[model samples]
Target chain A: MSSAAQGLRRTGSARRQPARPAWRERPKPATQAAKAVALAAVVLLVTVPFLIIVSTSFASNAEVVANGGWVLWPQHPTLNAYRELFDGGIVTHALWVSAGVTVIGTAASLACTIGLAYALSRRDVFGGKPILLLILFTFLFPPGMIPGFLLIKGLHLLNSYGSLVAPVLVNVFNLVVLRGFFQSVPEELYEAARLDGAGEWLILRRIVLPLSKAALAVVGLFYAVSYWNAWFYASIYLDSDHWPLQQVLRTYVVGGSQLADSAAGDASAVAAPQTIQMAVLVVATVPILLVYPFLQKYFTKGVLTGAVKS
Target chain B: MAIAERDATGRTGAAGASGADRRAGRKGRGTRLTRLRRDWVLLALMAPGVAYFLVFHYGALAGNVIAFKDYVPFDGLWASQWVGLDNFQKMFGDPDFWSAVLNTVWIALLQLVFFFPVPIALAMLLHSLTRDSVRKFVQSVAYLPHFLSWVIVVAVFQQVLGETGLLNNVLGDAHLHTVDVIGNPGAFKPLVIAEVIWKDCGWGTIIFLAALTQVDEQQYEAAAIDGAGPWRRFWHITLPSVRPIIVLLLIMRLGDILSVGFEQMLLQRASVGPDAAEVIDTFVYYKGLVGGDYGYAAAAGLFKGVVGAALVFAANKVAHRLGEQGVYR
Candidate 1:
């Protein structure tokens, strides 16, 4: 480094920086500037692409083309793209499909996982250890894709929505989390409840569920995000018409196929396919963004506890 | 639920508290039957999940028998002509399967070298920040992308880096040659690794960040008092503290090396062609699901599964030899 620049960085106003603990040394201004730049880059790198998609989705057709495909910010924001999407067309149907699957799938997954985790959390439940062993072994060597597909085919779940949720109803990781959280609850509490003649379900409902709200929310969010984002299974299992939003987005947007004009009746001045694609992207993404923030803090606890265990 | 305090008729009143203790001494079939009758409700609770694992996981697992059979759909999975090692021999000879294996390993290696340490570095940087609000805000923004579907992530990348994408548009305005990335086979690997990094690097920081947060402040303080600088403190305290986690995660990653983002590659496989994107999973998808070559595909998949399971066992053995807890007991 140049001596002058080094000297300036060393002598840069430390007053502007936050106070550090006595044991910690203040970083040089150059280091601070570099850190700020790195953080900003990290933040922007993640956020800018989403911004461009949203901006272009909302941008008018002329503005998008004028900017040569994508607009960073719209000159005149319009809801036409979303209007086309929600015009009771393929995308609208897909959105509903996705919402239904996420809701129903999350509920089903949470129920099964809770039951299994709670049952297994108790010390001497019949066949608890062996059942856990059976489940955990699947984690080590999961069923091969081909065999799994054949099983689905054999079961006649070829075009059924149950194909999506049934195979993946109870995620082992989420089960581990709930099990760990359930196990952590005091034995004394279970003792107290059992003394009062509380049944296993009663204790689980009254004590375990209330205490495990954070873990449940996090697990529910994971399941919802997974179901929402899933398309590959839908691609293989269901027909295009029954695909969720993610699968349709994959086909039309990423696959570069055009949306059929007849689905969205009239007034279709034919916006750029890129705009429509971005609009679909936003629509597919908004649900996750809406639910994630509320359940964000619980992620650390839920993930770490489960992760640490296995 | 709380209102129902009815206990089972025959079992002890304080059943659960002494359940594990009593079971330790009792091994009789009579006790086992007693235990079964006693825990019927719990058994009922576990029925759905157990049935799922049994049917979907193990039952599908049993379907691997088709790997040794010809798997004629008309003759059915069971009555199909047995092929013994014929499918394996075909998979061994077929250059496409080998290429898919090669691609999977190549991608997995690329991820290990380029994508593994990202969250570690990001975690350390976030840990060093003094301002709580800045740290929290940056974290919120950073991990948000992890929630997006691969389809959306791929679209975002295409929108930004494709032929007529933003970068090209800027280059065209400046009269510079626009780079072709989306379709360039050579760029496919880097593009994939970049997407993985962009989508998951932040989320990956969670474990390492948790590790860092648990580091004792006194270690840094003591290091400073001993005249150790920032780099020295980081090397001595932070690195050593998270080393076990890093090593554990590395072992887990190495064990599952054949998996290289199947859906992500499948989404973009058509754009760049299978040569650039056919990992083992995709190969199986195409060969089995799409092309109807069930027996051959199942053989290839079973091969991958066995190798993966063996690697996990080998890695776990190594972990135990090194005195780490490993993935499981």
Candidate 2:
């Protein structure tokens, strides 16, 4: 088709035009150096604290104390702090709680979001526009903290794990993102599926979901991260026994409380509090660090599609 | 057609009934039944999401009624005595409430003035990178902090800038005066603003970088060919292209100005004390949850919610007047 030829010609012209355009000329040496220095500063500002935290976590107790509570690099790397953290105590329990919440919540959230988004993505679906607006309106005027608290209390969900997941089951933003992605599917494909006598559910199961794996992964990661990072709800709703890791982290680390209290035993047997704190920080942060790179490339496209379309 | 005609005419005439008309009528009813059957699955699919909104959002919205009542835990929400704005009257007269409002507005303004432009500048910096690989590397490193929980972020700040933290340690080693950045009430606002900038500026740049990409390469080339310098081209072409996005974000920021970071302040509030750190949200948490003055706190919260919603509407109106797309049409 002529359209294919035009696309080829466009690519050909794009390739040719980039060959030394005036705007593409290299900047002056001074300007280049300044840019490099500015960028290096930005990179350093972000990376140094992480480096320090990792180093301190690995540092020996004596070295950490001698270095005045932080180590740039470990003199003697040890797993003593991490070992203490997982020795079946508060941190251990909280880690399990956080992991369970994240996995189950992400699955549940993604399922609900996909179901709703897919239904809404179809043109002329009954009451779809009203439902979409109803959802979007919540974003503009959120129920404040007090009322939200009261509702949770009234539901008798206080001091319960359900408080964490039930109150924030589906993020409207994620739903909107998935809806936009679903809407971008080609109409002709739907017609073809319909011609084959496939129902909406069959088409969704076979075609739409398979095609939206990237978006699903991205939204799932977002949900997972939110559930993992949530501490405020846990702080308010759950008692100390049921607190998740971030809430534990908030209480002992950021709140500057005694580690012995949170660890639920005598303080004499444990390693340095600084080391344990850094280890806890490392434990809290490591999962996101591990998963970030693989999903990093999807961030722009995934977020922008939602941002633009919505 | 004959059966339809008979039905429409309200005549009982089986002899005039045609096969096609009977079939058409039956087919119409069949299609309706089929459509209803098909829609049921979609409805079933949408049920959970709709129920979540209804129970969590709308249901919580209904609970705002407790603001006008003496909310007793034993009596529950409905059985509580109605005091009809006594809670609001108490909140309006409370000096502590005013102080919290002052702190919230002050911090919000500080963030607006200082923290708002960071992402734009960072985006411009990244956008100007001629090498794609370098841009990618820098971007990956930059956005890492945004994903961190405020707990972790506050902890990191404590470790690096606390009284005995890295900076103080380094200063002590260098025979310099050590500074107390964390836990210093005087430094809390700036410190919080700095934390906000460090955590979010890079992630914030995503939209602006996206906006930057939409700037026309042809126009830049044209400007360059006409001897327009880099700065001039950027000012003329790039800034204008991203201005609408900047405006849109500004409106959103204004709407959210009342919040000014609840979790961030909450984490640090006890250290600095409420005088320097009590934003509206933290104040609400302390008074309602900790102090158990539920009715008064709920009234304050309702006040915030209504003001926030109004601000959003007003900001959107302003945005529309300025010839930009607001959050909604």
Measured by DockQ, the strongest candidate is 2
lDDT of 1 by residue, A260-310 (tens): 686543345667777888999999999989987865666554243334545
Expressed as tens digits, the lDDT of each residue in B114-210 for candidate 2 is 9999999999988777655577788889989989999999999999999889999999999999998999999998899999998999899877776
What are the runs in model 1 whose C-alpha is more than 4 Å off?
A1-19, A264-267, A302-306, B1-30
Cα TM-score per model: 0.92, 0.91
- CAPRI-style class, candidate 2: acceptable
Cα RMSD of predicted structure 1: 7.8
Q: Model 2: per-residue lDDT, tens digit, A283-302? A: 99998998787557577652
> For model 1, which pairs clash?
none
Q: What lDDT does model 2 reach?
A: 0.82
Top lDDT hit: 1
